[model samples]
Target: MSLKRSLNRALAATTGLQVRKAPRPSAPPPPPAAPVYHEPAAEDRLLRRPVFVISSIRSGSTLLRMMLDTHSRLRAPHELHISRLEVGYGSSVSEYAMQNLGLERGDLEHLLWDRVLHRELVRSGKDFIVEKTPGNVFCHERIRDSWPDARFLVLLRHPESIARSWHESDPAKRPYEKAVTDVLRHVEAVDRARETLDDACTVRYEDITADPGRELRRLCRFLGLDYEPGMVDYGRKGDPELKRGLGDWRANIRTGTVQPGRALPGSGEVHPALLPYCDSWGYTS
Candidate 1:
């Protein structure tokens, strides 16, 4: 029939070669789209303008939380890990039912988080609530979506000190080398939140320990609250027991008074993995 087909048949006959069609390559499946979340209005959430402390592990957030809890109007709680709370549909019919009501999995989870925090605040009889979960830095965007009127407090510490403290917290379980890597991940997330959150107020562990009154005053101005003297003597109040799993469970925190932090690590003493972040955070000499 076709000239090329006839030539191929003649060549096949002469050389005993078989002609076979090559399989067509298939294009790869498209990547799954990222989930888009729309921010709910303030009235839809149980709590509005709640405060979140965004920080890396071993960054003195617990100390800050303890101080905030002493305030008359603020109630600071332990790490709730609300972002890890997820919702799932048990069946397709249930998923369709939820979809019909314009509720997604994230939306339901947001409502649950709001209710839990509101209950905590109501129980304490406090006007404002502060949540200081170190892991929340990773889900800061999700939190922003969940509470459009939320306020953020960015807490930073010397990256090298964070790595050392993390390793020292459990030397057997956390090797120094592994600690550096893990600490850096959190530091990067903090940087991202600081860059993106418009209402974020930043404070450093060093500043809080150096002159807590001054730092607390600055934070009060940002939070629109009056500085209470009790906040300075949080340890004397016997509130917010320093526990291991919830936060720093160390002798320094047990002292109650804001003790001066260990001297900043010298530039040469800083770990190689943490040097870049140290430079960015102004920890270098």
Candidate 2:
């Protein structure tokens, strides 16, 4: 203690100041790192916006499907025929599943529908899927309920054109009256959905084919995709298995062309019942 005190006194004498220790200076902490944003994986994007086509039968939906599928990253194949299972008192799988396994309805629906979609997307090696089932116009509501982010395209052919096609093109399978009635119902649905859903859009057969360059480019814009040249020549690159499955619509596609679908002027005989819906959807001319 004596030696330490002597050393302290000597240092103080030499310095001519107090021997109190000086505090160390501190550096400011570095600024917090900025948050990083990452884009979703392709599979996740497909889940978010599974391309579901909804349109009346014989409305040129196949053409639209093929076009979209031609995009290097898009896969629009034949009718997956997504059924509406959410309706009916006895139809809901969830109630029974809940009673038995205590599984949530949302979980069950996702497993039944979204999981199948995910598996199919993985299988096809495509980043996205566009399911083209004309009959699916009826199931539009259910599809939206299932995947809230689903992108839907509704093809609108002239009602007279659709009615005539059904009568002349598909007479063997269903009655003309049934076709007309079904078209009317589907048209009503399309109109309603167009009004309600921002993601759901209507594509006129006339517009797309008339200006494939412009309309298709516009469509690509709507889809948040870059326009691809192959989209216009989808027939050349179309899937054979899918082509055969489209019933009579395959006849035109078989020609390996993407020409505008033309019916002989006056080929269509407009029924009175279809007038209201046809007029409303902008097909009067």
Candidate 3:
């Protein structure tokens, strides 16, 4: 018999009907909690400062590196062969060595790769420091582990032309045969690495040579840099640091032949096995 009940009883008496309490309105559902969003901190957004290039020998990797070096934002180092040395073997090793290394190959590879990359990056001052090593194709994981935020530029060329060029060059003097085999092996390695890299790019040598401006623009876009026309003319500008051996193939090999043979000696035509890769990269048939 509280006041409210008394009032209700009074109301019931006056209205000739029983007074019943209204079921408590369901307490309005508690307001939904505000969504909390976490924005990445400044450190999180820093561009992964990789200055590394992985490409097969005779694949225009040198030219690509030189062109990239022309950019003020990048410093392309000469062929360091860091990965090759770390792997404890040269690319010229016979197939037997590959078998003998067996399970330990991966572990030894990881050790050598980690040491060289960490040392170089720790010592480098440039924002984008690149190691233009041909053997890196085989050591992408080691590179990726050391520099999780790193970027990779994989260069490719026609294997037939690569093999022919190697065969024609003095084997004893230049080790061209080994270079050819290495190029093929590295191509496959890069292809495998493509699957795991988050910020990786692939460029074809022919496409870069045929239309440097276009290719360079695309490359810059990939690297999140502003493209400059001067990158194409790096060689002509006499940049002393930029190596001159990039386009030597054009002068050294004859045109219209893919492989070395009696029919077409020294002619540097696109290799058939490599044609699909080149074509995929927008090379002319």
Report the Cα RMSD per candidate: 8.8, 25.9, 25.0
Error in Å for residue 114 of model 1 = 0.5
Cα shift from native, residue 269, model 2 (Å): 4.3
Model 2 residue runs over 4 Å out of place are 1-46, 84-107, 172-175, 236-240, 243-249, 263-269
Q: Which 10-residue window in model 3 sums to the lowest lDDT?
A: 256-265
Ranking by TM-score: 1, 2, 3
lDDT of each: 0.86, 0.68, 0.60
State the lDDT of candidate 3 residue by residue for 78-173, as single tens digits. Answer: 676665552434564643565464424444554455455545545655557677777777766766654566688877666665666555555775
| Candidate 2 lDDT by residue in tens digits, 1-285 | 677677788888898655565788899899844222222224423376788876777777877776777787788766766563322225566467554654444435444566667778788888888877776666666667666678877777888678767767658875788778867777777777677666566678888778776878887887888898867777544354544456334567655456767752352456788777667876664
lDDT of 3 at 54: 68
Candidate 1: residue 31 Cα off by (Å): 13
Every model's TM-score: 0.85, 0.71, 0.55
> Could you tell me the lDDT of residue 242 within candidate 3?
37
CA displacement after TM-score superposition, residue 215 of candidate 2 (Å): 1.6
Q: Any runs in candidate 3 off by more than 4 Å, and if so which?
A: 1-48, 84-126, 171-182, 236-285
